[model samples]
Target: MAVPALDTARAAPHTRPAPAPRPARRPGRAAVALAPAGLALALGLWGIRRENSMWRDESTTYQVAHRGVADIFHLLGEADVAHGLYYLLMHGVFALWDGGLLALRLPSVLAMAAAAAGVALLGHRLAGPRTGLAAGAVFALAPAVQRYAQEGRSYALVCAAVVWSTHLLLSAVANPRGRAWAGYAAVASVTCLLHEFAVLAVLAHGVTLLLARVPAPIRWAWARAASAVALVLAPLVIVSQQQAALVGWIGRPGQTELLGFLALTAVGLGCAVLPLRTSAAISLRTLALPLLILPAATLLAVSFIHPIYVDRYVLYSYAGFALLTGAGLEAALRAAPHPRAGAAALAAVAVAALLPYSIELRTPQSRLDDPMAAARAVRELTRPGDGVLFMPARRREPIMSSPGEFRGLKELALAQHAVPSGTLHGIELSAPRIRARMMTAERIAVVTDPPGRRPDDTPQERTKREVLAQHFRRCAEREVQGMVVLLYARPGAC
Candidate 1:
């Protein structure tokens, strides 16, 4: 009996020294990881709440789409631009949710959060849980990430899709089974539709399969799936062709913008790869290389032909680059004979990077006075028979681009005023020109942004301000929320 008991004790699963208690997840790990994303959300919410005063580009989104979702769809089929799908999605979201700044901004917030979670998961899977956690934390705190989170744009969505698709790719490559493959295919298709840069994901996957020696059958399946996507996107490529002229107008960025873009790209990708530095040295560098190098090169090359050089056009690359950088950072630490020293150093650097961002975002004033409050205030001041001139309004015309587009300046103007009927003009004419033209009107608000240069200005357009002083016996200008609205009335007309 004693001998038998001895044998059982020796065979017990716990016999190997309690298997070194699993490393306690870093203290307050969940909270620490979540901090960055929370900060981003808070900042984003505060940022867009105001009379953002429709930039010319922003104005266009409103004009046509405001008519109805159906109208947006029709525009997409006819004269829509590269961002049509995203614009379409926003059109529906706005129509259903009332198109408030908060509502339009919510989608980007969700996307940014989704991206953070995906980064963590990818980092964990690529290296270990600890690595994943660290990478995710850094990503949430990145400044570039915060900037895009509040805007009603597609960059945040593209970022999320890229990170998530990468996570799916990790699973698919490892298992390459029905569910994994299906997930990969579905995500890839959606990503492609969201932004064409998603095609780079397929290349990344191919590299991963090659490095891992995935089964031949699985590789062949991935190839077929990619081929199907290429075929579907072929039409989009043709569309890209038509847009070439418009896109080409954006010349190679000036030196400063290019430098800033490169820095942000580095910061974004660095966060993604920092957590997964072990188990697969391949996870960080190799994955990031194709994403960072190829897509940028391709876009720049095409810019020569098609002109798609906006940073957001390749926003998806930021996620992949972050993952790669995180992996590299983690791997360098693990490679050390004593990883504790390297880990401490990494943790310190991460803290340093995140602290500034956290502080900047926590303060709303730094982001600027609440825009939403200002917009609402302006609306209240509006009264019937009052003409509000958007002075130097031509620059802001892009924000309100179409005079009658759905989500553009027209909607904003209509929402606030009872302009039963009149043309909304974006002219350089001074207060006198406006006052003289609408002599019957009792009050006139000449609205315009600060001065900006133009290639050409009509002779009458110049010195209109000096001319206004001469014609309008009584003229007063007040800065209403950064807009110079000069109210002109006859000497006794007030």
Candidate 2:
């Protein structure tokens, strides 16, 4: 008998109904999710204070968040508009409790914990309980995750939003409904607002939909949801683009970034080919593989023209890495002759391997520089009424967050305080004004990037250096991580 045409077969009766929008609730799933989340929270809290140290980036968060609401809003219009939402959220957090360092970092810790739980639940829904648990564990143990989990920045929260959004996107695809689509759009929109790079994840999700070959109607529903997200995010995109100088520091992808992506790409491809059993209506490989590679790959590609790729910008991709790893490990466990023992051994080995890295993350030295340490150095070297100068102006950040340390030391070139000026480092005097001011001081302390750092060529910075070198003698100098503190005395004053 001749087979019916493909279109005729599709139209024939008794076609399988689309799967339910959500997986059936299974017992112990909550417990499975909690295990990994708790682990992540514990790890996050482990070094939350980083020995009471905060780096330059965290100092920016602390100082920005400490400003009045109006000041923060005003600052965003001029710079850092991309981080506006996160800075506002942190402002609220600091308002509730001014517990200093702990308060600054707790939101990120909690956000990462939520991300861990979302990864687990997503894995469990797509694969099995074992895969879910393993994935969560893998996500929690990642060194990069641990590093960012304790940071005050928005990356951790952004990651959490994207991961949960991916799970919701899966729901919309499984059983296309108006409410499901709405939920996906709302969460996905929040993810992009948190950090614009997260919009790439939405593109990755589109690829997954195409690979799964959802019905035309479902595809259109997804398109609508994705469009809604874009509409919601459009304003931020436009505003942030006008302020694109914020990311000017980003450079073309380096060897480290290229090698890292290639290695993970190979691993993700390998995981996709592995034998696996999962409950997902569409293969987990299709979802996880695209999620793992697309966002970072797209950023890397774009960096060729304009360098906007930063690993932390697409940190949510690690959730995809964890899911693939979990599925692969779960499959291996089952294939072992003694599954329980093999799994236990595997856990032990992972812990052993990650322990040293975990310990290193908790140290102050792990960060680029300790802002507090630099502050202490400044405080120790300068006397009240002595003049203090920040070379290149931006070095003011290290001492800006700890005003008490530099109290009474005249800021020789500052025209206005940072918060009052609604700028990060505040306005500086003109070159002539700075030179005249330097002549009046008997002693001056200058904070600068450590020796061998390229000097700023700006007019203000050049005048500061020229006057110091020609008129003052270097009486004493101290080098701290990421900063140098030098005390200069007028000739014969030392």
Candidate 3:
């Protein structure tokens, strides 16, 4: 006999009760993703104008990019071979608005913002959302990042490109798509072109891939992509190598730098080894360990053969450092009784720690030399018909960015304008010619490097000093931010 069917419709009202309240709609992923970019932009732009003076390197950027396109290309072949792409990019920027220090540095600020976002995305992909946010926050607070973000340089741009390329690499491995691999190669090549040292990042990528032991298809894709990048970058490498003397000033790593590097390594390794919940297919350690260690380690090892281990050259490694730090911090926060409060406290501490460094980065003393201050001093002291001499010759770079200050004062040693001469400072006159010019000048204004620093001692530089000392007496001297400006007159003329 069929059992009487229960009146399910009648019982539904009592049994179903109130539908569980739908979880409140959280912010969209896209909105959350924008947080890193927004934060980076804010930090980078803050107090950017406070350090309005251009430094020596930034003066070079200004002088080089201000030249005509053809002149820039010509100069690239003879000097600054490694910075061709960056100069070209800056050329576009200056073309739009060559106004104040802000125009000069805005590109770097935007690039840093992009880099922070890319770092966040990389961390998110490798670990989780909290780690990503933490990584981006740490990157924004890094003193080095803050320093470069407000300077007119290629480092920040290179860093952004490298971080994005790593993100593309993750995507390529996850999907094994040809388009994804091509994108990775394109970005990697662009990054290397921005600064040839960025090519070292490939070795870091190699370590990651090897450790992962990815599928044959993915491995092949990576090989093809890497090979393409290398082939595209070969010409730049060879050209930059020929111009290796550009970095001759870099000495071997000092005790302080080495010790600092060791400390960084210890911290990175500690974070990498920490137990944290991460994707099974891709561990945070596998992704971030190589990036944090290998580029710097390889560069340092090569420094024995050639002293090319500048901390700024491997600045992109900081992204990896941030990732590891973020993951460790996230794990800590998660373990706390109140995760949200723990996170807030950690963030507060980070901000407090970085506040001083952030302020320091905005000061003229933070850089090697303040060109604007030097120019202002020169303008105040110089008189009509006064002959200007650049002791060591390269010190002329400050005036190159402020040609108006030197207008009416003859450049006693200049053979040609910097663009025409295709040199950082204008090509100097012959030693005899420089001496003759100095002898004829009734009054001369001299710009020299900081006190206690030895001059370059080239024949022309030595002649400049010798002629001034023998024929003229120092009437007055003013110490500018990173230079000494002196007024010299014929003996007894003062």
* Best candidate (score: lDDT): 2
Per-residue lDDT tens digits of candidate 1, residues 368-483? 22323233333444445555443343333423332222121121122221112111222234445543545545555455553453422544344344444655544555444334
Q: Specify the highest-TM-score model's number.
A: 3
Task: Give model 1's TM-score versus the native structure.
Answer: 0.69
Worst 10 residues of 1 by lDDT: 414-423
lDDT-based ranking, best first?
2, 3, 1
Better of 1 and 3 by lDDT: 3
Worst 10 contiguous positions by lDDT, candidate 2: 1-10
Report every candidate's CA lDDT.
0.58, 0.89, 0.84
lDDT by residue for model 3 over 102-133, one digit each (tens)? 88889999999999988887777777777788
- Cα RMSD of all models vs. native, in order, equals 7.2, 10.3, 3.3
What's the C-alpha lDDT at position 439 in model 3?
Answer: 82
**How big is the positional error of residue 231 in model 1, measured in Å on the Cα after superposition?**
3.0
lDDT of 3 at 325: 87
Q: Please identify model 2 stretches exceeding 4 Å from their true place.
A: 1-27
